[model samples]
Target: MEILNSKEMIYSPTENREEKLSITGRVTFLSMVAGSVLALTNFISNSALAEDVIKIGTPLALTGGLADEGKKQQIAYDMWLRRVNAAGGINVGGKKMKVKLVAYDYQTDGKRAGQLTEKLITSDKVHFLAAPFGSGHTKITAGVAERHGVPIVASTASSLSVYNQGFKNIFGTLAPNTGMTEAMMKFFKKKLPGTQKVAVLGRDDVFPRAMAKSLSKGARNRGFDVVYDELYAVGTLDHASSLSKIKSEKPDWIYLTGYTQDLILLRKQMSDLGVTAPIVTMVTGPAYKEFVDGLGKLADGVTSSSWWHHATDYKSDDVFGSTKAFYTQFVKEQGHDPDYVHASAAAALIVLQKGIEKAGTLNRAKVRDAIASLDIVTFFGPIKFSPNGMNQVRDLPIIQVQKGKVSVLHPADIKNAEMQKM
Candidate 1:
């Protein structure tokens, strides 16, 4: 992943641009300041006090392989916080509380994320906790929050095991891998006809392993021949050997599941090895804009499933309205377009606000109960919690990257382009 520079702000105003104040000498300025001390002091004091405050803790992958996702999530969180504060904050038992986001970079390390979550709970004493960017990192931190009985909204964790852990304090914003892979299989069978042979490759992480298992099963159920299947460690930097094995089988399609860098390296090596055939469909490629930018022309013709795509052909305003607003603010703040990170973070914040409102109090237990019972109509659509704490909107659309832009190719409601052979 590419490293983003630290935040910067530029201010420019000439002397003549000053609106009203005109002080000729140092003594005049001092005398004028002393003359109207009461007004200035009262204004400053009241403005400071009028700012209500609520603390939020976030442990995200801000510096390592998942930095791209973390940066996007941070931008979304800040935007939501700004919007809430501008609207006079959230109503908690008839009192307003301004939201304050406190984020820590876990650098994509699970151990570091767990440690930071402990500090956030004990030292910072945040009012609420938001989950991290990566699934692996989120799992580690969820344990910490569960031990402390803190209510947490897990933003980007799509694995089913994340909810199966029986941690009542935790809730996932994204659909499970089983459901997502099912949607992908349905699209593949309808779109790619007479192509039965399939190959599945993924790193031996919780998310990829689960996805590969379910996706391979889905392919078989759809009458496709599961030619080859393999798993590697998350640290695998090269897939030449794996690709060589896959080429020997000459499967009709390749289903890759893993982190962004892992997928990029696999795609780059596949191109270099000259083993191009069948369609390569990944699970999380559309979640990051870098997936398109990194591969450039090589990304063309590659198709992947997306939970939230920017293209809006549906007549309903919910999808297009929310996506456009989110994209505009995300690009303005982070200088990039919206991705899964932005959508996940925005959904988490909306869910949190809804839960607090329903509970009528900010108590941890009350909030947890409220989250379990929430049926929210979010910017993404209706988000209802299942018995196991998963979102009811689990079906995702399959999209393809064509001509440097993403176009949906599934479920007719939003398929903008046809799927091409890779």
Candidate 2:
């Protein structure tokens, strides 16, 4: 009699009756073999399904001028990833799916950022995308995401120019640049009635240029004379020429808009040149701890605005609990306090997750629509996108560095302290 095995067939003598199987026994054995095969097939199918995960592609400036901010953005996303995975991943269409982030270092080059974004969508086949840091990089990458019909939540871009391009797939966490300076201008008008003359200086970049122009217009509208408004070239180390002109103008208020390192240098140059303005407001640097760490006492009385703050008491029904809780968790994970940049980055991720959960499907169009219609408040603050796909629910909080700490100066309702004179 011959018995069939997986690899070969073997012939056995009838004398070995104990080892040889009877006809009925052979049929039973075959039934067990068939059942084992079916079980193995099912196990493989289930394993494949269980391995399914949502991948989010991100391009960050991990080794260039924007490295500090880009690293902060990564940290923010990492925090969200830990929390979501710990809670058994995101519930999508009644199935729990883990998330995987595919990130690349674009080295702060806008063109490289755009190329990486396209590669992420086409090659990596990511389900969603996160915008790169800064307006220039975000704008470049956003165009790629828009062309592919992929929704991207921009974390650090506040330039209105980026959102004005009619890209329906793009959404921003920060308010427009114009909105950032509105509260500060109104506060100056009501609080410092005598402040009139103003000088605006910004880096020759998309965001800083737009921010300076917006601040100049806002100041002029608020009854302040625009003394001197100029833009210095990017990477301009010596601002003596500009500072000399600004000093001659003797402006009552000076608004400086630039990146963190640029602003830090500009502040030091202002001190070196003995250029003094009674009211000094920087667009973004002063709100970050690096600025204070870079200038120490020099950072005092320097006012800036931000999209979110850790001191906020806003409540949320999201994963981070409340504003205070978010801050607490961020400190625990990162070993330091989070700034507006971190909050904005984290909020962008939160907004994306909320949209996915609401849509209950991975359909791109449905998730995009869900994000467009979002009106919920999170730990970052109220988040609602306008028809232009820019966040409209949260107002920028004006903050001034006082005694080595950030103090909210405007929107009296949430203000932690009054602005002190420089």
Candidate 3:
């Protein structure tokens, strides 16, 4: 804007030509001062507006083994970002600040993920962080965030060890592995009372290994005989030998834990070896549609437990309003339904958003305090962080894939069907 106006200049009637030049000199001096003030004011306004934005940085595994899961997380983050900005951004201390997401692909390397997380803090200067895909990656990155004093939310990491490290800056969305195991154990013991023998298998990675160990303990505690408990090498292309040993066990219940591809390949290999159990359970993989797409009929009668499902009849005044509302919009935009990974990813940002709003500033310490003290309900579930920073919501959903439809089979109240025998 033009700050100095020529029409506002004063003129003296008695001034001669020489005096007029002196009057012009005074006007020029005033103009310079006026211009200086105007420039200074504009600079201050621009800087304040720039500071009002919240930049959230994340290292995603957009390539290699974790690429697919990383994309699911990206979709959730993108959806939340659009909604928050569209609603005129978050109101922080009476000032509205828009959000910007800064992300880099970590290529499924834990070391690289840690390196990028440090870079996001030192170089990108992000106000917050969303951790990488699984517990293996989140653990590596969350430590870096803690040392730098940046608040990080992990959407998928549920292993107890992830948060037991005494790091205050790290928070997770999914409840601990025990919740998933306990829910499955209770439901199976009640329904399949005759179930005696159980076999377990999992990928030799952080989250999967942790889940397998927890599930095996829970099964043994529930009086089921746990046999053939083992973990395969990470990124293994073959599980034939493992499947053969499991088949030899003649177990009534077979429990497998791994990511999407690993589960799919294991299921296919199980079919090839003619290894079929009366009750087959897989952690997490059945919650995703890709598992069914990859295995087709092989996915049927596969029971699994997840931290969330869109069919949950929960509501919130937050971003998506309710589970049904989120499901409708996600299906409309992505042309497919969302899985637990998607819901958990979106919920993680919602937690971060609430922390920022409650603290009324992007100050890292303040936001971390607000998040740590939070105990609230969301569209996904009730979240109350344990003292250790992992979600304390224990109401996990147990599901089964039947004829291409993922159905809730346990917890009695929310159950849509009973377990089917193959």
Candidate 1 residues 24-85, lDDT tens each? 56655754565446445644664575345566788877888778778778877777777788
**RMSD of model 2, in Å?**
12.8
What lDDT score goes with residue 249 in model 3? 90
lDDT (Cα atoms) of all candidates against the true structure: 0.75, 0.83, 0.85
Candidate 1's TM-score = 0.83
| Model 1, residue pairs in steric clash | none
Prediction RMSDs, each to the true structure: 7.5, 12.8, 12.2
Which model is ahead, 1 or 3, in terms of lDDT? 3
Residue 118 in candidate 2, Cα distance off native in Å: 1.4
- Cα deviation of 315 in candidate 2 (Å)? 1.1
Candidate 2, poorest ten consecutive residues by summed lDDT: 1-10
> lDDT by residue for model 3 over 1-422, one digit each (tens)?
00111122111121222234445778657655655565556456645755977889899988888898998999999999999999988879888889878788888989989988888788667899999899889999999999999999999998888999999999898999888888888877778788889999988888889989998988878778998899998869999998999999999889999888899988889889999888898877888888888889999999999888777878786888888888998999999988889999999999999999989998999999999998877888888798999998576889999998899986666889878986
Off by over 4 Å in 3: 1-48
Best by lDDT: 3
True-vs-predicted CA distance for residue 83, candidate 3, Å = 0.9
